[model samples]
Target: MPGFPRRLTSRAAAGLALLPALTILLVAHLGSTSWTIWISLTSSRMLPNSNFVGLRQYETLLNNDRWLVSAQNLAVFGTLMVVGSLLVGLLLAIAIDQRLRVENTLRSIFLYPFSMSFVVTGLAWQWMLNPTHGIQKLVRGWGFETFQFDWIVRQETVIYTLVFAGIWHAAGLVMAIMLAGLRGIDEEIWKASRVDGIPAWRTYVSIVIPMLGASFATAGILLSASVVRLYDLAVAMTNGGPGLASEVPAKFVMDHLFERGNLGLAAAAATSMLVTVVSIAAPLLYARSRARTAETRR
Candidate 1:
Protein backbone atom coordinates (compact mmCIF):
# COMPACT_ATOMS: atom_id res chain seq x y z
CA MET A 1 0.00 0.00 0.00
CA PRO A 2 2.93 2.33 0.64
CA GLY A 3 4.02 2.24 -3.05
CA PHE A 4 0.44 2.35 -4.43
CA PRO A 5 0.09 6.15 -4.22
CA ARG A 6 3.38 6.77 -6.08
CA ARG A 7 2.50 4.18 -8.76
CA LEU A 8 -0.98 5.70 -9.12
CA THR A 9 0.50 9.18 -9.42
CA SER A 10 2.99 8.00 -12.08
CA ARG A 11 0.27 6.20 -14.04
CA ALA A 12 -2.01 9.25 -13.86
CA ALA A 13 0.78 11.50 -15.10
CA ALA A 14 1.55 9.19 -18.03
CA GLY A 15 -2.13 9.02 -19.03
CA LEU A 16 -2.46 12.78 -18.75
CA ALA A 17 0.57 13.22 -20.99
CA LEU A 18 -0.98 10.93 -23.62
CA LEU A 19 -4.37 12.70 -23.57
CA PRO A 20 -3.60 15.15 -26.39
CA ALA A 21 -2.24 12.47 -28.72
CA LEU A 22 -5.25 10.22 -28.04
CA THR A 23 -7.64 13.10 -28.71
CA ILE A 24 -5.94 13.91 -32.00
CA LEU A 25 -5.88 10.26 -33.09
CA LEU A 26 -9.57 9.75 -32.27
CA VAL A 27 -10.92 13.07 -33.51
CA ALA A 28 -8.51 14.23 -36.18
CA HIS A 29 -7.57 10.93 -37.82
CA LEU A 30 -10.24 8.32 -37.08
CA GLY A 31 -13.09 10.82 -37.08
CA SER A 32 -11.92 12.34 -40.36
CA THR A 33 -11.48 8.89 -41.95
CA SER A 34 -14.98 7.81 -40.83
CA TRP A 35 -16.53 10.99 -42.19
CA THR A 36 -14.69 10.62 -45.50
CA ILE A 37 -15.85 7.02 -45.85
CA TRP A 38 -19.43 8.13 -45.16
CA ILE A 39 -19.18 10.97 -47.64
CA SER A 40 -17.83 8.59 -50.29
CA LEU A 41 -21.05 6.54 -50.06
CA THR A 42 -23.21 9.60 -50.64
CA SER A 43 -24.28 11.63 -53.66
CA SER A 44 -22.67 14.76 -52.27
CA ARG A 45 -21.19 17.12 -54.84
CA MET A 46 -19.50 20.46 -54.15
CA LEU A 47 -20.54 20.01 -50.49
CA PRO A 48 -21.18 17.41 -47.79
CA ASN A 49 -24.68 15.96 -47.56
CA SER A 50 -26.78 13.03 -46.29
CA ASN A 51 -27.61 11.76 -49.77
CA PHE A 52 -26.47 8.13 -49.11
CA VAL A 53 -25.94 6.97 -52.69
CA GLY A 54 -24.27 3.63 -51.75
CA LEU A 55 -21.09 3.07 -53.80
CA ARG A 56 -22.33 5.00 -56.83
CA GLN A 57 -19.36 7.38 -56.67
CA TYR A 58 -16.90 4.47 -56.66
CA GLU A 59 -18.71 2.97 -59.66
CA THR A 60 -18.37 6.25 -61.52
CA LEU A 61 -14.73 6.52 -60.48
CA LEU A 62 -13.97 3.08 -61.88
CA ASN A 63 -15.69 3.89 -65.18
CA ASN A 64 -14.05 7.28 -65.60
CA ASP A 65 -11.28 7.23 -68.22
CA ARG A 66 -9.20 9.83 -66.40
CA TRP A 67 -9.39 7.85 -63.13
CA LEU A 68 -8.37 4.66 -64.91
CA VAL A 69 -5.43 6.45 -66.56
CA SER A 70 -4.42 7.93 -63.22
CA ALA A 71 -4.53 4.52 -61.54
CA GLN A 72 -2.40 2.97 -64.30
CA ASN A 73 0.08 5.83 -64.14
CA LEU A 74 0.31 5.41 -60.34
CA ALA A 75 1.15 1.74 -60.71
CA VAL A 76 3.90 2.55 -63.18
CA PHE A 77 5.31 5.41 -61.16
CA GLY A 78 5.17 3.55 -57.82
CA THR A 79 6.85 0.42 -59.17
CA LEU A 80 9.66 2.19 -60.99
CA MET A 81 10.20 4.82 -58.31
CA VAL A 82 10.41 2.32 -55.44
CA VAL A 83 12.64 -0.10 -57.34
CA GLY A 84 14.90 2.55 -58.81
CA SER A 85 15.34 4.34 -55.50
CA LEU A 86 16.15 1.13 -53.69
CA LEU A 87 18.63 -0.09 -56.29
CA VAL A 88 20.36 3.25 -56.67
CA GLY A 89 20.47 3.82 -52.92
CA LEU A 90 21.86 0.36 -52.25
CA LEU A 91 24.59 0.87 -54.81
CA LEU A 92 25.48 4.23 -53.34
CA ALA A 93 25.53 2.77 -49.82
CA ILE A 94 27.77 -0.07 -50.98
CA ALA A 95 30.12 2.33 -52.67
CA ILE A 96 30.37 4.51 -49.60
CA ASP A 97 30.80 1.52 -47.32
CA GLN A 98 34.05 0.80 -49.13
CA ARG A 99 35.61 3.64 -47.08
CA LEU A 100 36.12 6.06 -49.88
CA ARG A 101 38.14 9.17 -49.27
CA VAL A 102 35.15 11.41 -50.05
CA GLU A 103 32.49 9.41 -48.22
CA ASN A 104 31.24 12.34 -46.09
CA THR A 105 31.17 14.72 -49.03
CA LEU A 106 29.38 12.19 -51.21
CA ARG A 107 26.80 11.52 -48.50
CA SER A 108 26.08 15.23 -48.01
CA ILE A 109 25.75 15.80 -51.75
CA PHE A 110 23.45 12.80 -52.20
CA LEU A 111 21.33 13.69 -49.15
CA TYR A 112 21.03 17.34 -50.14
CA PRO A 113 18.27 16.61 -52.65
CA PHE A 114 16.16 14.81 -50.04
CA SER A 115 16.45 17.88 -47.80
CA MET A 116 14.83 19.98 -50.52
CA SER A 117 11.06 19.84 -50.89
CA PHE A 118 9.43 17.73 -53.59
CA VAL A 119 8.14 20.94 -55.15
CA VAL A 120 11.71 22.09 -55.61
CA THR A 121 12.82 18.72 -56.96
CA GLY A 122 9.92 18.68 -59.44
CA LEU A 123 10.64 22.18 -60.67
CA ALA A 124 14.35 21.43 -61.02
CA TRP A 125 13.69 18.24 -62.95
CA GLN A 126 11.13 20.01 -65.08
CA TRP A 127 13.66 22.62 -66.07
CA MET A 128 16.29 19.98 -66.67
CA LEU A 129 13.95 17.87 -68.81
CA ASN A 130 12.33 20.70 -70.73
CA PRO A 131 12.72 20.26 -74.49
CA THR A 132 13.29 23.88 -75.43
CA HIS A 133 15.89 24.84 -72.81
CA GLY A 134 16.80 21.65 -71.02
CA ILE A 135 18.88 18.58 -71.91
CA GLN A 136 17.67 18.38 -75.49
CA LYS A 137 18.50 22.00 -76.16
CA LEU A 138 21.80 21.80 -74.36
CA VAL A 139 22.78 18.71 -76.28
CA ARG A 140 21.69 20.28 -79.55
CA GLY A 141 23.84 23.23 -78.73
CA TRP A 142 26.71 20.76 -78.40
CA GLY A 143 26.18 19.69 -82.09
CA PHE A 144 24.01 16.66 -81.27
CA GLU A 145 21.05 17.89 -83.29
CA THR A 146 19.11 14.60 -83.49
CA PHE A 147 19.48 13.63 -79.84
CA GLN A 148 16.05 13.69 -78.25
CA PHE A 149 15.60 13.58 -74.47
CA ASP A 150 12.17 15.10 -74.18
CA TRP A 151 10.33 12.52 -72.12
CA ILE A 152 8.34 15.11 -70.11
CA VAL A 153 6.24 16.26 -73.07
CA ARG A 154 5.38 12.76 -74.30
CA GLN A 155 2.30 10.99 -72.90
CA GLU A 156 3.84 7.53 -72.80
CA THR A 157 7.06 8.70 -71.16
CA VAL A 158 5.91 11.49 -68.81
CA ILE A 159 5.25 9.02 -65.99
CA TYR A 160 8.80 7.73 -66.37
CA THR A 161 10.14 11.24 -65.98
CA LEU A 162 8.24 11.55 -62.71
CA VAL A 163 9.79 8.27 -61.61
CA PHE A 164 13.23 9.70 -62.33
CA ALA A 165 12.51 12.72 -60.15
CA GLY A 166 11.04 10.57 -57.37
CA ILE A 167 14.08 8.33 -57.35
CA TRP A 168 16.47 11.27 -57.31
CA HIS A 169 14.69 12.77 -54.32
CA ALA A 170 14.23 9.53 -52.35
CA ALA A 171 17.44 7.63 -53.11
CA GLY A 172 19.48 9.62 -50.64
CA LEU A 173 17.21 8.83 -47.71
CA VAL A 174 17.36 5.15 -48.58
CA MET A 175 21.12 5.41 -48.94
CA ALA A 176 21.45 6.87 -45.46
CA ILE A 177 19.32 4.12 -43.98
CA MET A 178 21.23 1.38 -45.79
CA LEU A 179 24.57 2.88 -44.91
CA ALA A 180 23.61 2.69 -41.24
CA GLY A 181 22.57 -0.89 -41.73
CA LEU A 182 25.82 -1.68 -43.49
CA ARG A 183 27.86 -0.08 -40.73
CA GLY A 184 26.06 -2.20 -38.14
CA ILE A 185 27.30 -5.45 -39.73
CA ASP A 186 30.02 -7.21 -37.76
CA GLU A 187 33.56 -6.94 -39.11
CA GLU A 188 33.90 -10.64 -38.31
CA ILE A 189 31.25 -11.41 -40.92
CA TRP A 190 33.33 -9.74 -43.62
CA LYS A 191 36.50 -11.52 -42.46
CA ALA A 192 34.70 -14.84 -42.35
CA SER A 193 33.36 -14.33 -45.87
CA ARG A 194 36.83 -13.42 -47.16
CA VAL A 195 38.37 -16.41 -45.43
CA ASP A 196 35.81 -18.69 -47.06
CA GLY A 197 36.81 -17.30 -50.52
CA ILE A 198 33.50 -15.49 -51.03
CA PRO A 199 33.65 -12.55 -53.40
CA ALA A 200 32.71 -9.16 -51.92
CA TRP A 201 29.70 -8.84 -54.23
CA ARG A 202 28.58 -12.34 -53.30
CA THR A 203 28.94 -11.53 -49.63
CA TYR A 204 26.81 -8.42 -50.03
CA VAL A 205 24.12 -10.19 -52.06
CA SER A 206 23.86 -13.28 -49.87
CA ILE A 207 24.76 -12.25 -46.33
CA VAL A 208 24.70 -8.48 -45.93
CA ILE A 209 21.44 -7.83 -47.75
CA PRO A 210 19.58 -10.44 -45.76
CA MET A 211 20.89 -8.90 -42.54
CA LEU A 212 19.56 -5.44 -43.47
CA GLY A 213 15.94 -6.57 -43.59
CA ALA A 214 14.87 -3.98 -41.02
CA SER A 215 16.48 -1.13 -42.94
CA PHE A 216 14.97 -2.29 -46.22
CA ALA A 217 11.52 -2.58 -44.64
CA THR A 218 11.77 0.88 -43.10
CA ALA A 219 12.81 2.48 -46.38
CA GLY A 220 10.17 0.52 -48.30
CA ILE A 221 7.34 1.56 -45.99
CA LEU A 222 8.39 5.20 -46.24
CA LEU A 223 8.60 4.96 -50.03
CA SER A 224 5.18 3.26 -50.21
CA ALA A 225 3.62 6.00 -48.07
CA SER A 226 5.10 8.60 -50.38
CA VAL A 227 3.78 6.70 -53.37
CA VAL A 228 0.24 6.74 -51.93
CA ARG A 229 0.37 10.50 -51.37
CA LEU A 230 2.28 11.39 -54.53
CA TYR A 231 0.78 14.81 -55.26
CA ASP A 232 3.26 17.65 -54.89
CA LEU A 233 5.87 16.30 -57.36
CA ALA A 234 3.24 15.55 -59.99
CA VAL A 235 1.70 18.96 -59.45
CA ALA A 236 4.98 20.87 -59.59
CA MET A 237 6.65 18.88 -62.38
CA THR A 238 3.95 18.17 -64.97
CA ASN A 239 0.74 19.30 -63.25
CA GLY A 240 -0.69 16.01 -64.55
CA GLY A 241 -0.24 17.31 -68.04
CA PRO A 242 0.74 15.66 -71.36
CA GLY A 243 -2.89 14.47 -71.67
CA LEU A 244 -3.18 13.22 -68.08
CA ALA A 245 -0.29 10.89 -68.63
CA SER A 246 1.29 11.69 -65.27
CA GLU A 247 -1.90 11.94 -63.23
CA VAL A 248 -1.83 10.01 -59.94
CA PRO A 249 -4.57 9.04 -57.47
CA ALA A 250 -3.79 11.86 -55.05
CA LYS A 251 -3.84 14.44 -57.85
CA PHE A 252 -7.08 13.02 -59.18
CA VAL A 253 -8.64 13.25 -55.71
CA MET A 254 -7.48 16.86 -55.35
CA ASP A 255 -8.78 17.90 -58.75
CA HIS A 256 -12.18 16.32 -58.02
CA LEU A 257 -12.42 17.78 -54.53
CA PHE A 258 -11.30 21.36 -55.19
CA GLU A 259 -11.29 22.04 -58.92
CA ARG A 260 -14.12 19.79 -60.11
CA GLY A 261 -16.30 20.24 -56.96
CA ASN A 262 -17.06 16.51 -56.78
CA LEU A 263 -16.88 15.74 -53.06
CA GLY A 264 -18.24 12.20 -53.34
CA LEU A 265 -15.76 11.23 -56.04
CA ALA A 266 -12.87 12.78 -54.15
CA ALA A 267 -13.84 10.98 -50.94
CA ALA A 268 -14.20 7.70 -52.83
CA ALA A 269 -10.77 8.08 -54.37
CA ALA A 270 -9.24 8.93 -51.00
CA THR A 271 -10.94 5.94 -49.34
CA SER A 272 -9.67 3.64 -52.08
CA MET A 273 -6.15 4.89 -51.54
CA LEU A 274 -6.48 4.38 -47.78
CA VAL A 275 -7.78 0.85 -48.26
CA THR A 276 -4.96 0.01 -50.65
CA VAL A 277 -2.29 1.31 -48.28
CA VAL A 278 -3.86 -0.54 -45.35
CA SER A 279 -4.13 -3.79 -47.25
CA ILE A 280 -0.49 -3.71 -48.36
CA ALA A 281 0.73 -2.57 -44.95
CA ALA A 282 -1.31 -4.93 -42.80
CA PRO A 283 0.34 -8.13 -44.05
CA LEU A 284 3.84 -6.68 -43.86
CA LEU A 285 3.24 -5.38 -40.32
CA TYR A 286 1.77 -8.70 -39.14
CA ALA A 287 4.71 -10.63 -40.58
CA ARG A 288 7.23 -8.29 -38.99
CA SER A 289 5.49 -8.51 -35.60
CA ARG A 290 5.36 -12.28 -35.78
CA ALA A 291 9.03 -12.43 -36.75
CA ARG A 292 9.96 -10.22 -33.83
CA THR A 293 7.90 -12.37 -31.45
CA ALA A 294 9.57 -15.51 -32.76
CA GLU A 295 12.99 -13.97 -32.34
CA THR A 296 12.21 -13.00 -28.76
CA ARG A 297 11.11 -16.55 -27.94
CA ARG A 298 14.23 -17.98 -29.56
Candidate 2:
Protein backbone atom coordinates (compact mmCIF):
# COMPACT_ATOMS: atom_id res chain seq x y z
CA MET A 1 0.00 0.00 0.00
CA PRO A 2 2.90 2.38 0.68
CA GLY A 3 4.05 2.11 -3.02
CA PHE A 4 0.59 3.03 -4.38
CA PRO A 5 0.97 6.82 -4.01
CA ARG A 6 4.37 6.80 -5.66
CA ARG A 7 3.05 4.77 -8.59
CA LEU A 8 0.02 7.05 -8.87
CA THR A 9 2.22 10.10 -8.82
CA SER A 10 4.48 8.67 -11.55
CA ARG A 11 1.49 7.86 -13.75
CA ALA A 12 0.08 11.33 -13.19
CA ALA A 13 3.39 12.92 -14.11
CA ALA A 14 3.55 10.85 -17.33
CA GLY A 15 -0.01 11.83 -18.25
CA LEU A 16 0.73 15.52 -17.57
CA ALA A 17 3.82 15.34 -19.76
CA LEU A 18 1.82 13.82 -22.62
CA LEU A 19 -0.95 16.42 -22.33
CA PRO A 20 0.56 18.72 -24.94
CA ALA A 21 0.92 15.93 -27.49
CA LEU A 22 -2.62 14.69 -26.79
CA THR A 23 -4.00 18.18 -27.28
CA ILE A 24 -2.12 18.55 -30.55
CA LEU A 25 -3.43 15.19 -31.76
CA LEU A 26 -6.99 16.18 -30.89
CA VAL A 27 -6.78 19.61 -32.45
CA ALA A 28 -4.37 19.29 -35.33
CA HIS A 29 -5.18 15.84 -36.68
CA LEU A 30 -8.76 15.09 -35.62
CA GLY A 31 -9.95 18.67 -35.84
CA SER A 32 -8.53 19.19 -39.31
CA THR A 33 -9.89 15.88 -40.60
CA SER A 34 -13.31 16.71 -39.16
CA TRP A 35 -13.28 20.09 -40.87
CA THR A 36 -12.33 18.48 -44.17
CA ILE A 37 -15.17 15.97 -43.84
CA TRP A 38 -17.62 18.79 -43.07
CA ILE A 39 -16.40 20.69 -46.12
CA SER A 40 -17.09 17.61 -48.21
CA LEU A 41 -20.65 17.56 -46.90
CA THR A 42 -21.22 21.16 -47.93
CA SER A 43 -21.44 23.12 -51.19
CA SER A 44 -18.06 24.78 -50.73
CA ARG A 45 -16.36 26.53 -53.63
CA MET A 46 -13.57 29.13 -53.68
CA LEU A 47 -14.94 30.27 -50.34
CA PRO A 48 -15.88 27.82 -47.57
CA ASN A 49 -19.51 28.84 -47.24
CA SER A 50 -21.54 26.51 -45.00
CA ASN A 51 -24.33 25.46 -47.30
CA PHE A 52 -24.88 21.82 -46.39
CA VAL A 53 -25.37 19.38 -49.27
CA GLY A 54 -24.95 15.81 -48.19
CA LEU A 55 -23.18 13.46 -50.65
CA ARG A 56 -23.69 15.69 -53.70
CA GLN A 57 -20.04 16.61 -54.05
CA TYR A 58 -18.99 12.98 -53.78
CA GLU A 59 -21.51 11.97 -56.42
CA THR A 60 -20.18 14.64 -58.75
CA LEU A 61 -16.62 13.52 -58.03
CA LEU A 62 -17.44 9.90 -58.83
CA ASN A 63 -19.08 10.94 -62.08
CA ASN A 64 -16.16 13.13 -63.21
CA ASP A 65 -14.10 11.44 -65.95
CA ARG A 66 -10.84 13.04 -64.87
CA TRP A 67 -11.23 11.73 -61.33
CA LEU A 68 -12.09 8.28 -62.65
CA VAL A 69 -9.06 8.28 -64.92
CA SER A 70 -6.82 9.51 -62.10
CA ALA A 71 -8.04 6.69 -59.85
CA GLN A 72 -7.42 4.13 -62.57
CA ASN A 73 -3.92 5.45 -63.17
CA LEU A 74 -3.15 5.28 -59.47
CA ALA A 75 -4.17 1.60 -59.27
CA VAL A 76 -1.91 0.64 -62.17
CA PHE A 77 0.96 2.90 -61.14
CA GLY A 78 0.90 1.87 -57.49
CA THR A 79 0.86 -1.84 -58.27
CA LEU A 80 3.70 -1.72 -60.76
CA MET A 81 5.79 0.73 -58.74
CA VAL A 82 5.55 -1.36 -55.58
CA VAL A 83 6.32 -4.65 -57.31
CA GLY A 84 9.14 -3.23 -59.42
CA SER A 85 10.83 -1.36 -56.58
CA LEU A 86 10.67 -4.34 -54.25
CA LEU A 87 12.16 -6.66 -56.84
CA VAL A 88 14.94 -4.25 -57.83
CA GLY A 89 15.74 -3.40 -54.23
CA LEU A 90 15.87 -7.01 -53.12
CA LEU A 91 18.22 -7.88 -55.97
CA LEU A 92 20.55 -4.98 -55.14
CA ALA A 93 20.56 -5.96 -51.49
CA ILE A 94 21.42 -9.57 -52.36
CA ALA A 95 24.22 -8.45 -54.68
CA ILE A 96 25.73 -6.23 -52.01
CA ASP A 97 25.57 -9.07 -49.48
CA GLN A 98 27.75 -11.12 -51.83
CA ARG A 99 30.85 -9.16 -50.57
CA LEU A 100 31.46 -7.34 -53.85
CA ARG A 101 34.79 -5.48 -54.13
CA VAL A 102 33.14 -2.09 -54.69
CA GLU A 103 30.16 -2.59 -52.35
CA ASN A 104 30.08 0.94 -50.96
CA THR A 105 30.36 2.56 -54.40
CA LEU A 106 27.66 0.33 -55.80
CA ARG A 107 25.36 1.02 -52.84
CA SER A 108 25.88 4.77 -53.17
CA ILE A 109 25.25 4.70 -56.90
CA PHE A 110 21.94 2.91 -56.42
CA LEU A 111 20.88 5.09 -53.50
CA TYR A 112 21.84 8.47 -55.01
CA PRO A 113 18.56 8.82 -56.87
CA PHE A 114 16.52 8.31 -53.68
CA SER A 115 18.28 11.27 -52.01
CA MET A 116 16.84 13.49 -54.74
CA SER A 117 13.41 15.04 -54.42
CA PHE A 118 10.56 13.75 -56.55
CA VAL A 119 10.63 17.05 -58.47
CA VAL A 120 14.23 16.43 -59.45
CA THR A 121 13.57 12.79 -60.36
CA GLY A 122 10.61 13.77 -62.51
CA LEU A 123 12.45 16.62 -64.27
CA ALA A 124 15.50 14.48 -64.92
CA TRP A 125 13.43 11.64 -66.35
CA GLN A 126 11.37 14.13 -68.35
CA TRP A 127 14.56 15.34 -70.04
CA MET A 128 15.97 11.87 -70.55
CA LEU A 129 12.70 10.57 -72.00
CA ASN A 130 12.08 13.52 -74.30
CA PRO A 131 11.53 12.14 -77.81
CA THR A 132 13.37 14.72 -79.89
CA HIS A 133 15.84 16.35 -77.50
CA GLY A 134 16.90 13.40 -75.36
CA ILE A 135 17.62 9.68 -75.71
CA GLN A 136 15.94 9.27 -79.07
CA LYS A 137 17.94 12.11 -80.63
CA LEU A 138 21.22 10.89 -79.14
CA VAL A 139 20.63 7.34 -80.33
CA ARG A 140 19.57 8.36 -83.83
CA GLY A 141 22.68 10.58 -84.19
CA TRP A 142 24.79 7.50 -83.40
CA GLY A 143 23.43 5.76 -86.53
CA PHE A 144 20.19 4.23 -85.35
CA GLU A 145 17.46 6.24 -87.03
CA THR A 146 14.92 3.38 -86.75
CA PHE A 147 15.36 3.11 -82.99
CA GLN A 148 12.27 4.27 -81.07
CA PHE A 149 12.39 4.73 -77.27
CA ASP A 150 10.01 7.62 -76.77
CA TRP A 151 7.09 6.80 -74.44
CA ILE A 152 6.69 9.93 -72.33
CA VAL A 153 4.75 11.89 -74.94
CA ARG A 154 2.58 8.95 -75.95
CA GLN A 155 -0.74 8.89 -74.05
CA GLU A 156 -1.03 5.10 -73.87
CA THR A 157 2.46 4.50 -72.47
CA VAL A 158 3.26 7.67 -70.46
CA ILE A 159 2.20 6.02 -67.22
CA TYR A 160 4.86 3.31 -67.62
CA THR A 161 7.52 6.01 -67.81
CA LEU A 162 6.24 7.37 -64.51
CA VAL A 163 6.45 3.85 -63.05
CA PHE A 164 9.99 3.46 -64.35
CA ALA A 165 11.13 6.74 -62.79
CA GLY A 166 9.32 6.01 -59.54
CA ILE A 167 10.91 2.59 -59.19
CA TRP A 168 14.32 4.05 -60.00
CA HIS A 169 13.96 6.60 -57.23
CA ALA A 170 12.52 4.18 -54.67
CA ALA A 171 14.50 0.94 -55.24
CA GLY A 172 17.58 2.16 -53.40
CA LEU A 173 15.67 2.81 -50.17
CA VAL A 174 14.13 -0.63 -50.41
CA MET A 175 17.57 -2.13 -51.03
CA ALA A 176 18.92 -0.46 -47.89
CA ILE A 177 16.00 -1.84 -45.90
CA MET A 178 16.34 -5.35 -47.30
CA LEU A 179 20.09 -5.31 -46.74
CA ALA A 180 19.59 -4.44 -43.08
CA GLY A 181 17.17 -7.32 -42.73
CA LEU A 182 19.55 -9.67 -44.51
CA ARG A 183 22.33 -8.71 -42.10
CA GLY A 184 20.15 -9.49 -39.08
CA ILE A 185 19.59 -13.07 -40.23
CA ASP A 186 21.52 -15.63 -38.17
CA GLU A 187 24.70 -16.85 -39.81
CA GLU A 188 23.87 -20.26 -38.37
CA ILE A 189 20.94 -20.52 -40.79
CA TRP A 190 23.22 -20.06 -43.76
CA LYS A 191 25.67 -22.59 -42.40
CA ALA A 192 22.90 -25.07 -41.80
CA SER A 193 21.66 -24.66 -45.36
CA ARG A 194 25.22 -25.11 -46.65
CA VAL A 195 25.61 -28.26 -44.54
CA ASP A 196 22.41 -29.56 -46.13
CA GLY A 197 23.94 -28.90 -49.58
CA ILE A 198 21.09 -26.58 -50.55
CA PRO A 199 21.68 -24.37 -53.56
CA ALA A 200 22.18 -20.66 -52.78
CA TRP A 201 19.38 -19.36 -54.99
CA ARG A 202 16.97 -21.95 -53.70
CA THR A 203 17.85 -21.06 -50.08
CA TYR A 204 17.29 -17.39 -50.75
CA VAL A 205 13.97 -17.98 -52.43
CA SER A 206 12.63 -20.61 -50.07
CA ILE A 207 13.96 -19.54 -46.68
CA VAL A 208 15.64 -16.10 -46.68
CA ILE A 209 12.78 -14.27 -48.33
CA PRO A 210 10.20 -15.69 -45.97
CA MET A 211 12.31 -14.44 -43.06
CA LEU A 212 12.40 -10.88 -44.45
CA GLY A 213 8.67 -10.35 -44.01
CA ALA A 214 9.19 -7.36 -41.73
CA SER A 215 11.42 -5.61 -44.26
CA PHE A 216 9.00 -6.34 -47.06
CA ALA A 217 6.11 -4.94 -44.99
CA THR A 218 8.08 -1.80 -44.17
CA ALA A 219 8.99 -1.15 -47.82
CA GLY A 220 5.45 -1.93 -48.96
CA ILE A 221 3.88 0.52 -46.49
CA LEU A 222 6.39 3.24 -47.37
CA LEU A 223 5.72 2.76 -51.08
CA SER A 224 1.98 2.69 -50.51
CA ALA A 225 2.00 6.09 -48.80
CA SER A 226 4.16 7.50 -51.56
CA VAL A 227 1.71 6.15 -54.12
CA VAL A 228 -1.27 7.80 -52.43
CA ARG A 229 0.54 11.10 -51.84
CA LEU A 230 2.14 11.18 -55.30
CA TYR A 231 1.95 14.69 -56.75
CA ASP A 232 5.29 16.33 -57.35
CA LEU A 233 6.48 13.64 -59.75
CA ALA A 234 3.36 13.75 -61.92
CA VAL A 235 3.30 17.53 -61.87
CA ALA A 236 6.94 17.82 -62.87
CA MET A 237 6.92 15.15 -65.54
CA THR A 238 3.61 15.31 -67.42
CA ASN A 239 1.50 17.84 -65.53
CA GLY A 240 -1.16 15.11 -65.56
CA GLY A 241 -0.89 14.87 -69.36
CA PRO A 242 -0.55 13.75 -72.45
CA GLY A 243 -4.18 14.38 -71.49
CA LEU A 244 -4.65 12.99 -67.95
CA ALA A 245 -2.64 9.87 -68.76
CA SER A 246 -0.49 10.17 -65.64
CA GLU A 247 -2.96 11.86 -63.31
CA VAL A 248 -3.08 10.64 -59.69
CA PRO A 249 -5.43 11.17 -56.77
CA ALA A 250 -3.31 13.71 -54.94
CA LYS A 251 -3.04 15.80 -58.10
CA PHE A 252 -6.75 15.47 -58.65
CA VAL A 253 -7.48 16.82 -55.16
CA MET A 254 -5.08 19.74 -55.62
CA ASP A 255 -6.51 20.64 -59.01
CA HIS A 256 -10.05 20.87 -57.70
CA LEU A 257 -9.16 22.63 -54.44
CA PHE A 258 -7.10 25.36 -56.05
CA GLU A 259 -7.13 25.34 -59.83
CA ARG A 260 -10.75 24.25 -60.26
CA GLY A 261 -11.96 26.30 -57.25
CA ASN A 262 -14.27 23.61 -55.97
CA LEU A 263 -13.37 22.85 -52.39
CA GLY A 264 -16.34 20.56 -51.75
CA LEU A 265 -15.47 18.24 -54.58
CA ALA A 266 -11.79 18.41 -53.65
CA ALA A 267 -12.61 17.53 -50.08
CA ALA A 268 -14.66 14.59 -51.26
CA ALA A 269 -11.80 13.33 -53.40
CA ALA A 270 -9.32 13.87 -50.58
CA THR A 271 -11.49 12.08 -48.03
CA SER A 272 -11.96 9.13 -50.34
CA MET A 273 -8.21 8.81 -50.88
CA LEU A 274 -7.51 9.13 -47.18
CA VAL A 275 -10.11 6.51 -46.36
CA THR A 276 -8.68 4.13 -48.93
CA VAL A 277 -5.15 4.42 -47.52
CA VAL A 278 -6.27 4.10 -43.90
CA SER A 279 -8.44 1.10 -44.66
CA ILE A 280 -5.57 -0.79 -46.25
CA ALA A 281 -2.96 0.23 -43.68
CA ALA A 282 -5.00 -0.13 -40.50
CA PRO A 283 -5.41 -3.91 -40.65
CA LEU A 284 -1.72 -4.54 -41.35
CA LEU A 285 -0.71 -2.27 -38.48
CA TYR A 286 -3.12 -4.00 -36.14
CA ALA A 287 -1.78 -7.42 -37.09
CA ARG A 288 1.77 -6.25 -36.54
CA SER A 289 0.83 -4.87 -33.16
CA ARG A 290 -0.77 -8.17 -32.18
CA ALA A 291 2.25 -10.12 -33.35
CA ARG A 292 4.56 -7.93 -31.27
CA THR A 293 2.36 -8.41 -28.23
CA ALA A 294 2.29 -12.17 -28.72
CA GLU A 295 6.06 -12.31 -29.12
CA THR A 296 6.51 -10.30 -25.95
CA ARG A 297 4.20 -12.62 -24.06
CA ARG A 298 6.00 -15.67 -25.39
Candidate 2: Cα lDDT at 165: 95
Candidate 1 displacement at residue 128 in angstroms:
0.7
TM-score of each: 0.97, 0.93
Q: Among all windows of ten consecutive residues in candidate 2, which has the lowest summed lDDT?
A: 273-282
Q: Looking at candidate 1, what is the lDDT of residue 133?
A: 96
Q: All models: lDDT? A: 0.95, 0.95
Give the runs in model 1 whose Cα sits over 4 Å from its true position. Answer: none
The 10-residue segment with the lowest total lDDT in model 1: 276-285
Cα lDDT of model 1 overall? Answer: 0.95
Model 2, backbone clash pairs (residues 3+ apart or across chains), number: 0
lDDT of 2 by residue, 28-115 (tens): 9999899999999999999898999999999998999999999999999999999999999999999999989999999999999999
* lDDT, model 2, position 135: 96
